[model samples]
Target: MTGKTVGVLGFPFSKGQPKGGTELAPKELRAAGIVDRIQALGNNVIDHGDVDLSGLPADSKVGVAKNSLAVGEANKKLSEDVAKYLKKGEQVLLLGGDHSLGIGSLHGHTQVQPDTVVVWVDAHADLNTPFTSDSKNMHGMPLAYVVKEMAQFLPKTPGLEWCKPSLSTKDIVYIGLRDVDPGERKFIEQLGISCFSMHEVDKFAIKDVVEKALSQVDPSGNRPIHVSFDVDAMDPIHAASTGTKVPGGLTLREAFYIAEEIAATGRLSVLDMVEVNPKLGSPEEKEVTVANTVSVTAKFYGSKRQGDVPPNYVIPRPQA
Candidate 1:
């Protein structure tokens, strides 16, 4: 994060899920000053505007990957754009419409770093493939594309036609997962990917958990790390405006602590504040959506209280 130019890129396609709340996330968050907040961190911040999806559904009709072709197109363009920023030695903060944006961002970062690590924070594994996904939402399948696990099912596109693995399975560390899909769970287990489910978070602690995630993502001397943060990863109490709010998510303090600690590492290259929905819960919930998103983004950018103490996160070793 040191000497990195911060750029804001928006991905406003959210047909990936049944809910349509995420399309408004960027606009709402902008009005709440997410851009201004980034500039205050003393970094060269620039907003690259949003991708023009041309109102295509998350999937397309021209590919075997059903509904996922258009998703690939948008993501490929996003990857190209974000890759340019990364190549310029900039820290790109992607404003996501849903977790689906991870596809493009991951592609972009991997194209530049080639060996970057991804720390996916969410309430679900999001590793489902076209064959495995019962819901067919492209959002839940981004990790599948990022990891290059299933190539045969992917659509054929110029830059995205082939599956070049982004982050390795072992390199990925999923934190704050709870309501994972069944097939997705088997995929994660088969891959032996590191994960700290909500049960683990409750048993151990957030501090230790964050430490473990950070270590796994960057064991080789703090290489470039991308954090794809989905607001639903936080406990529903902390963020109830998400389209897919799961119970028992990371608390606001714990979520911010992740950002703060990751920023402290200085190896953190890309920061994504995703899944901030403005159309959920009571009136109070929408109001808090941007605030929580802003808080975590601030923490990621080296903003913190002088005497604030990190949380006591107990990260117990996995059972062999």
Candidate 2:
């Protein structure tokens, strides 16, 4: 138990990409006992319920970006909600409909904590711009919309006008990257963002990768941390229910190690756990995915693999 109050918000939205059933993640995760599990860890848990994603504008394709209006509208609401909870002094945990929710989560977090540093744990960079992306999925372009350095490259996206670029390219570090777009690769090189792809993860190990990522992003070690974790960061075996499946990803231990290390920082202010689509896999696969996700999430809030002790306890004297 970190003695922190965690505010949980669910985004039952899937318009960021061309997928259904992602909208059901919040309900599914709750059914799996996400709130209760965190409560057992000794923190005050408040389930804020799912964000209302109704009555969005009937948006058409804006250039290459699909569902621009709906994505933007939903995220605007998400941004406001996230900022509200953070202002109340509770650490926020955002459960997603897709990675697109990152736009609002990051936007809202930076609004309250301007000096926040981001550790993006995903197999894909999610850094593509509309012009650069072939699929035109908003989920793949969340970072592009919010990163200040990429602002010049972005066109005037219609529904996203309310979102201002709040994060600098240097304020973010990437881990578990295995599949990256060519344009995204160019962006990373040109912008000089620190990236530790699976290659580095294999070479340096998860522990070193996490340490180096944190050090590179926040050398002073005092900045508030936002971990935007996509379940697809793990190998398909661990998280097979996501829309995007990139093989040869992080192992379960590696995933837990990252969460544990981040939890140890004590500066984790917001965590976005995204891309668990319940509609994508077999029944058994979905169960495994949800269970693994819940387990990993618990680690971020002080649940130890070695088992946790209650905050205070005493040794019982024999027959006292």
Candidate 3:
């Protein structure tokens, strides 16, 4: 991943769920030195700023989906921005307001790199349709909107008419899932998507889980990778500020291992770092969540646990 120009885009809109502080993730992450950390890894970093989420329609629920109009419009704008940055040959790093932002990121990525494979790292399967969702939050339904196989199961959502399902089920792989819903489990089994739940992680180990996930999604190992990582995928101890954190999630080391492995692939084109809510926890918890999130993100951009030397560095020598 050296020499790559990383484009950082923030989605400061959180209409996908009933949360407020999530909209502040981009600002918080920036304040925590995310930009400097990535730049230190010897890659050129460009902060593209946050996506505009203003003046969107406040339409009522479209079927069982809540915040339909606002979520759809914001995602449309996000998709365009993502595609623009990708066209400029920069690897896109999306800092999200919530998991719902995955809808737009995936849509825009497929517009430029249709053959990209997805590695969705989250505690929840997030494959529920509007009808299947009890909360009606769009955050839990992003996968349903983007997956081609799930299209038939979706209702005609008003604001989401622009979202055409483009990704095949076979092109996606899941990691770190532990709190999957019944509907999501049905879809996973019926559609044959490769999933590495906490059960699998415990049995096969993180290294093997990652290797098998990549192999199943992109057997040729040449396709571009898009990792949609929800910080809630980590245990509540590591990420207590998220909205829907389930216990017994990935450890900090396991999370870093996954990110490091993805970075080594050299095919990571877009990454979504999401679900950090600064308002949900105490100052100490928020600090821990933000720090952990930043660390995991840096790993995906070439920071290594062993250590990293800046590009073109030379050891100090005695002066003549």
Cα lDDT tens digits for candidate 2, 1-320: 54789999999999998879788888899999998888888889999998888898987545558999999999999999999999999999999989999999999999999999999999999999998999999999999999999999998888999999999999999999999999999999999999999999999999999999999999999999999999999999999999999999999999999999999999999999899999999999999999999999999998899987766656678894
Best by TM-score: 3
TM-score of each: 0.88, 0.97, 0.98
Q: Tell me the tens digit of each residue's lDDT in model 3 across 1-320.
A: 57899999999977888978899999999999999999989889999899988788987545559898888999999999999999999999999889889899999999999999999999999899998899999999999999999999998998899999989999999999999888999999999999999999999999999999999999999999999999999999999999998999999999999999999999999999999999999999999999999999999999999998988799999999
Instruction: Please report, as a residue range, the 10-residue window in candidate 2 with the lowest summed lDDT.
Output: 307-316
Which window of ten consecutive residues has the lowest lDDT sum in model 3? 58-67
Q: Cα miss at 30, model 3 (Å)?
A: 0.5
Candidate 2 TM-score versus the reference: 0.97
Which pairs of residues have clashing backbones in candidate 2?
none
* C-alpha-based local distance difference test score of model 2: 0.93
- Superposed model 3: Cα runs more than 4 Å off: 61-63
lDDT of each: 0.77, 0.93, 0.94
Residue-level lDDT tens digits of model 1 in 1-320: 33557888888866556677788888888888888776766556788888776745344242434356666677777788888888887788888788877888888888889777888899988887766777667788888887855454444433246446567787688998998887788878887888998888888798889887777666765588889999999988878898888888898988888888888878777777788777778889888877888878878877785643323435689899
lDDT measured at residue 11 in model 1 versus the true structure, 0 to 100: 80
